[model samples]
Target chain A: MAQQVIIKVDNLVKKFGNFTANDNLTFEVFKGEIFGFLGANGAGKTTALRILCGLSSPTSGQVEVAGFDVYKQTNKIKMNIGYMSQKFSLYEDLTVRENIRFFAGIYGLSRKIIRERTDELLNKLNIEELGDKLISSLPLGWKQKLSFSIAIFHRPQIVFLDEPTGGVDPITRRQFWDMIYDASNDGITVFVTTHYMDEAEYCNRVSIMVDGRIEALDTPETLKKTYNAKNMNEVFLMLARK
Target chain B: MDNPAISIENIIKSYDKVVALDDISFEVDKGELFGLIGPDGAGKTSLFRILTTLLIQDSGNAIVEGFNVVKDYKKLRTIIGYMPGRFSLYPDLTVEENLRFFATIFNTTIEDNYDLIKTIYRQIEPFKKRLAGNLSGGMKQKLALSCALIHKPEVLFLDEPTTGVDAVSRKEFWEMLKELQKKDITILVSTPYMDEASMCDRVALIQNGRILEVETPEEIVKLYPHSLWAVISSDMYKLESDLQSFEKSVSVYRFGDSIHLSVKDDDIYGSDIKEYLESKNQNKIKVEKIDANIEDCFMALMNNNDL
Candidate 1:
């Protein structure tokens, strides 16, 4: 079976005045695949991600997300994708249930479906009892998990997570990856950016951006073999140092 | 035989009804690189503040360089270098100005302690004219460490130094820490990354305001009580869910591209898991015995503590 290309970019160029943030980048993310967008600080990864998420317009070239053109059909593209940022954007004063309802409502989910899914999500994450608890009282891991469940509550075709597990413990990080894998298994493509190189291994394919360009793009196995590196950390250093 | 570089006994801290540190106790030997390993809100910052005399503990005692954290704080302040988690340097000041300002505050000249920070300072020296805010993440870290060491303190306390830095920069920063360790400076560093735990001479795994275990990285990994197996399949996500249903599977969690399964010693075999997943029509099934790391030990401890 041929996997469909869910995200397509060809010579995508994004510039901020004299500087090129994403310089003629080209890549394809297949359906249901965990595609890792990796880069160091000031490497233009966030710019490229924002452009893909329909939050920013590119300077030139072709870009498509979820079968919608980024330039003209941004609204349609936004309707079919979910985005979770590095910062925990949940309301601190609101209860967990209230936060879920607020986000779900904004996403245009039906009230009945929202109620059903909210219950299901709470049960799945083993936090059903904490639904009435204020978000500020939750631990960092619980808040992260809750935020992730809320992001995908509408069941978007693609999800964008930027450093979703930063400052989390290893065990919690593993669990978060499990959540990502579960989403991938459900036929939803995952587009994630992270600073942890070890996480690059979890992706089916990864594209490393260096100095506003895609320096390497391949499966973790092939990249490690091609670079003759023991792990993704070494692979990242090899390219980033250049 | 000499007193440890830093010592804490039954230190407790709380904010309102939330207990941040409960009966925490630890010691750092002279010239040792120690790590406080845990997730966020694990009381690392609270503990660092107490040791540096920036915050008072609710109960118990902490001593740095033979001075009580509470009573002798005035004297203790001069003997320790502290870099907080947040970038607290003067953003408006140039890199050199910040370094010089910090040196003057400690009543010393950058030239007098130039040898102590020569290695780290050289990295950021080129950016001396740049404002601290305009420098890159890695460069800012270098500048901050330079300022912290300007006074040549007897010990260093770094709270999550590499929290938001890039992986390449993180590796470089750890290397610089190794260089600093060579100077025989007692260092206590806290980070959430388990991989960094192995770099320290010893680490204390803390969670929910309590220390789970304190030992060398190698020894902590050796504490993983059960044998571990790496399991992979064509559909790893489904495989993980299916494996969790198996009664014999003690604990299963994702590790990189594969799932690590912990089983009773000499009880569960690789062949048994392969047959089970194969019977369920999971393709490309591979299960093999593997060695555990500090992360595995931490998970085991967390699980046990939760139960």
Candidate 2:
């Protein structure tokens, strides 16, 4: 049995002026795998993520997302992937139901499908009563959970989550990871970036970026054993310090 | 007894209908590294604001360096340094300009207090001419700390200083904080990172504007009342759901490669869990009784509070 590679990047280089933001990165994300993108601040994680999300083009290299070429099929790539960041997830003024409907519509879902999915999503989250309430009024944890649900609402082949659980409670954070696992179980490839080391350990495999380069990419257990470190935090400190 | 660096006596703060801080009280001794750990909307920022004299509490009182927060706010301001959760430095100003501006406002020259911020300032010296807004996240944080320390206050308050910072930079920032504490400056820092709590001499685990426990990290970890077990199997997700359905499971949380399960009964052995999961056809199951860390203690406290 062969694993399906949903995102393929080979010698990917992204430069901004003279600075190489992503330097010769190569990695493949398989279907239904939770890929953890770990990096220090200013380590090109954002640049690579932007490139993968089709918001920016790569400087050089072969890149494919959802079977679409990065250079020529950016729109198709965007259509096939979902993105949610902690900074921008949902419209604050819009009601929960409205935010869901708007994003579903943007994803080109039909009116009938959007209507049905909205109810299903609200009920699944057990927030059916709060559907009419504005997103701004919801708690941070609730908003974050709802944002994640909406991000995968269109059923994109891959969902990019950027620090999706930042500043949430421990229980809520674990619940959020459980949701990620559920998404992976449902066959959506999860590509995420987080500063929390524990969250990094939750990934099926993790790639640590250093100075705009992929310094290490492997399962957390292997990485920990290879580095002789107790946990991902020590592994990160060891690699990042170097 | 000698005067504690900072003291809060039943400090209560609210806005309209929202109670930001509910009779919060704590004390930090002089030259101690104290951490206020909690999630966002935990009223950390509100408490910081009140102590820094930026906002007034609706009731109760706070004292910093023996100066009343309300009555002697002016005096308190002159002796305390505050780095807000958000970047409050002038974004348009150059790094050097911002540091110098902060120095001037404190009735001191850059040269007069250069030694106080020497270590932090030296790192940002190359970027002295760069606009504060243009610096990277890590560099911006370094610059902010430099500016905060330019006045060399006896007490420092850092609100979520490492919130969005990466692991490497966060380690470096804590090193800087440790360096600062050596100078006999009382430091009060807040962060959502549970791992960082161990670095502090003592920590106050706060949630919902109320303090859950204030003790050394070791003491806090010792407070976890349940025996924890780490369980892993072929199916990670199913392992979590299955553990949740277990009759004796009190709480089941996904922790990295394994599920940390707390049984309702303490005497439940690892073999018992293994047998149950094996019955469910979970392969390669590994179960071990493990000690709790700060995060586990925090989760237990949070759950108990909810109940």
Candidate 3:
């Protein structure tokens, strides 16, 4: 029924000593759907993303990722998901194809699939000529798209992309999301965080965070309608100022 | 003292074997607010650094306020104000102290040029006693900008000045730049945001260390080659792949929830493209011929260049 709720997070509270980063947070991301988790910088988006990725543990409250309890089954969750962070997460010294191979190996992908996928990804990006080129040699736009493709190459059940399009051109960012859509269509759940308001409008459902808690959670249209706003920027402004 | 603000001819800059700028030639009219619109590593920073005498170009020449970047760097340094992309204020120094330090570097006092930066300085006046690093991002932007304007340089160089700040801060920062331009100062700012390109009097879209197109934002958008459509459906991914199968598909680029398609012919309408989508299992498809903005033109130009 409804894919049995692939991710269920309940009142997840994460604090750094006296400072509360994620306060009384609760959310659920169903399987086979794009769930966007968005927030301003220092609003606890990264804190929550780190917790969900099993990179860090919540200070309190129940949490689960891909049916694995974050407290006890972090490695299992890691295997079921892929993460592309805001920072350039790939090795600069590695070639485009080599980065793909390295990330694939970390996820226990076979050599044959890695080879096939690397070629396919390179071809899809229309940059197969640059496959052997150093990652540093490519433009930031190309590097971001390549890093995005490599992150989800292992075909995990869920992929977490944090600000995947920051600092890229509109064309490159456009193409990057196309590949994201291709993956989600193949039944991979996308749990992404972004500061780009335009990108948030693409999600099936999005939760806007403010002051360590969800201020809004709904489809773009629903949030827009509820707040009597014309664009996502206004809706965010209304919520942030409130 | 009497030059057309800035002028460049066949400017080429490289870092060792890597070419950062390739035969770039552009000029900023006297008191004009010119913009360099491109992504990271697009050489906007390199060009700014060269114009400000911070980095020397490999070849060609540039003149800023009658001073050359290579031959008259010391003279150029005294006449140009530069605010770098990153916030480069001293963490330990207070806002007032930082301002004073920059004033001292230019052989001037804050009191001498306080009138020039009065409007911007007022915003950070309350936090003047606070450590530069302790201020918020928006506040730090104001402080950095105020310090740059402390000496009242004849030409201003701002490199990616609004990145990482909120939309509100970006808007506010641009407003401040416009006010600065009105004081008979030549302003040159570089940014990655396509939307910000319109705020300038003219912009140059650069890529791969090459200048793609240089024109006003409205003129660039007006010259877009093809008719555009924003198509959306239930199965968005398939819509992208299937749109390629249609005869009208020239190029498909994902834009938020919709796929913006550029077609070959004007007579081949969206209705015809809709029928093709129906055959591909995408329902409730909406399509229309819409206006192409600056970003669309940037991509179209990029596509044309690639071909």
RMSD (CA, angstroms), candidate 3: 3.2
Worst 10 residues of 1 chain B by lDDT: B298-307
Q: TM-score of the B chain in model 2?
A: 0.97
Q: Name the best candidate (by DockQ).
A: 2
After superposition, candidate 2 runs with Cα above 4 Å error: B305-307
Write candidate 3's Cα lDDT for A1-242 as tens digits: 54658788899999899989999998888887888887665678888988988989999999999889999999999999988865857888988888888889988989999998888888877888999998888778777777777777877888898878767777778777777777888898998876566787778898988889999899988999999987777777677654
lDDT of 1 by residue, B37-93 (tens): 999989999999999999999999998989999999999999899999999999999
Model 1 TM: 0.94
Ranking by TM-score: 2, 1, 3
- Most TM-score-accurate candidate: 2
| Clash number for each model | 0, 0, 0
Write candidate 2's Cα lDDT for B27-139 as tens digits. 99999999999999899999999999999999998999999999999999999999998998999999989998999999988899888888888988998999999998888
Better of 1 and 3 by TM-score: 1
lDDT of 3 by residue, B159-240 (tens): 8887765555566789898999899888999887888888999988887788888888888887878778989898776787
Q: What digit string (tens of lDDT, one per residue) describes model 2 on residues A204-237?
A: 8999999999999999999999999988999999
